[model samples]
Target: MKQSFVYILKCSDGSYYTGVTSNLSARMFKHNSGFYPDCFTFNRRPLELVFYCEFTDINLAIEKEKQIKKWSRAKKEALINDDFDELVNLAKKSFGK
Candidate 1:
């Protein structure tokens, strides 16, 4: 069975980029080589692979990628740091209903 991955890269500009791919190595190479000029990490070269999670289903990987793309930077940082408690705390609504 093939594995898919949802990955986050820390760009040179201190921003995060989220993506999904089946081949992690090739994808990293492409990003570093500017293979996709229009891609977020292209001009933001010198990207560092900060976080990644593997899934058996490509759909799941893509779904996770989409979800992470919408996450607040604090939440994403909590996840990257493996701070589940902080992640949950960050998910709470800041303002009252």
Candidate 2:
């Protein structure tokens, strides 16, 4: 069974990019090489692989990718730092309510 992964790349510009791929290493290479010129990480080269999670289901990975894409930078940082509690706090503190 092929594994799916949702990964985060920390760009040189201090921004985060989220993506889903079956092969994490290969995707990272593609991002670094600027294979997708129109991609967010293309111009923001010199990215570091900061976080990743693997799943046996592609749907799950895609869902996670979508969820992360909507997150604020602060929440993303909390996630990257493995701060689940902080993530929950930020979610609860959302002003949109």
Candidate 3:
């Protein structure tokens, strides 16, 4: 069975970038090497792999990547820090609490 990964990178500018790939090492190398000039990480060189999760299903990995891409920075950080309580709190619908 093939494995897929959803990863997040911390850029030089202190920003985050989310992506999915089947080859984590190769993808990290490409991102750090500026393989794609127009890629988000290209300009934000010197990226650090902050977090990653593997899935046996590529479709599920892709779905997770897309979902994460829509998350706020705080939410992403909560995930990276493995703070499940914070993640759940962030996911709640705010009601001016």
Candidate 4:
């Protein structure tokens, strides 16, 4: 089975980019090489890979990527830092529930 990955890149400008890929190494190379001028991470080069999770299903990977892309910076940081408690707390605050 082919593996998929959901990744977070910390841009040079202190912003984050979330994406999903089946070939992570190749994707990283493309991002760092300015392969896509119109891409969000194109100008935000010198990116640091802050987080990644593997999935056997591409659909799940894509779903996770979309979800992460919608997250607040604080929530994304919490996930990158492996702070699940903070993640849940931030989610609750964001939802006000």
Candidate 5:
């Protein structure tokens, strides 16, 4: 079965970009190479791969990408740092709001 990936890229400007891809290496190359001038990562070049999770199902990968894209920066950072405690706290805080 083909694998899919949900990834987070840290832009040079300190912003995050979330995406889903079947070919991570090729996607990273394209992002760093500025293959598409209109793309979000085009001007935010020199991106660093911060986080990634593999999925056997493309639908699940896309769903995860969408979910991450809606996350706050703090929540995203917690996830990137593998701070599950902080992640839970942030989610709870958001839920209470």
Candidate 6:
């Protein structure tokens, strides 16, 4: 059985990064250790796992990753904080509310 995970990392610079992987722990280790060649987190080492959601299906995980990647920084923060209402507010503001 294979499990996919959608995860977000808060970089040293306070920026958020969204990605999906089958091996979350291994991926985090690689990101922190710079073992994954040419990875986006290669230079952004020491990232903290701010958020993660597990999915049984790869497509669902990938879809969620893409969606999170498209979110605004405020929205991402809201998500990390588990503030659903804040996420709604961010979305409304994004649309010129």
Name the candidate that leads on lDDT.
3
Better of 1 and 2 by lDDT: 2
Give each model's whole-structure lDDT: 0.93, 0.94, 0.98, 0.94, 0.95, 0.89
Q: Which candidate comes out best when scored by TM-score?
A: 3
Tell me the tens digit of each residue's lDDT in model 6 across 1-97: 6999999998887778899999999988888988986877777777999999989999989988998899998889999999999998777744455
Stretches > 4 Å off in candidate 6: 93-97
lDDT of 2: 0.94
Off by over 4 Å in 3: none
Q: What tens digits encode model 5's per-residue C-alpha lDDT throughout 1-97?
A: 8999999999999999999999999999999999989999999889999999999999989999999999999999999999999999988744353
Q: Please report the TM-score between candidate 1 and the true structure.
A: 0.95
Model 6 RMSD in angstroms: 2.1
The true-versus-predicted C-alpha distance at residue 45 of model 5, in Å, is: 1.1
Q: For model 3, state the Cα shift of residue 82 in Å.
A: 0.4
TM-score per prediction, in order, is 0.95, 0.93, 0.96, 0.94, 0.94, 0.88
Q: Model 4: per-residue lDDT, tens digit, 50-81?
A: 99999999999998999999999999999999
Query: What are the clashing pairs of model 5?
Result: none
Clashing residue pairs in candidate 1, if any? Answer: none
Cα deviation of 74, candidate 5, in Å: 0.2
For model 5, where is the 10-residue window of minimal lDDT?
88-97
How close is each model in CA RMSD to the real structure? 1.0, 1.9, 1.3, 1.9, 1.8, 2.1
Candidate 2 has which clashing residue pairs, if any? none
Residue-level lDDT of model 2, residues 21-93, one tens digit each, is 9999999999999999999998999999999999999998999999999999999999999999999998885
Better of 1 and 6 by TM-score: 1
Pick out the ten consecutive residues of candidate 1 with the lowest summed lDDT.
Answer: 88-97
**Stretches of candidate 2 exceeding 4 Å from the true structure:** 94-97
- Residue-level lDDT of model 3, residues 1-97, one tens digit each, is 8999999999999999999999999999999999999999999999999999999999999999999999999999999999999999999996785
For model 5, what is the C-alpha lDDT against the true structure?
0.95
RMSD of 5: 1.8
TM-score result, candidate 6: 0.88
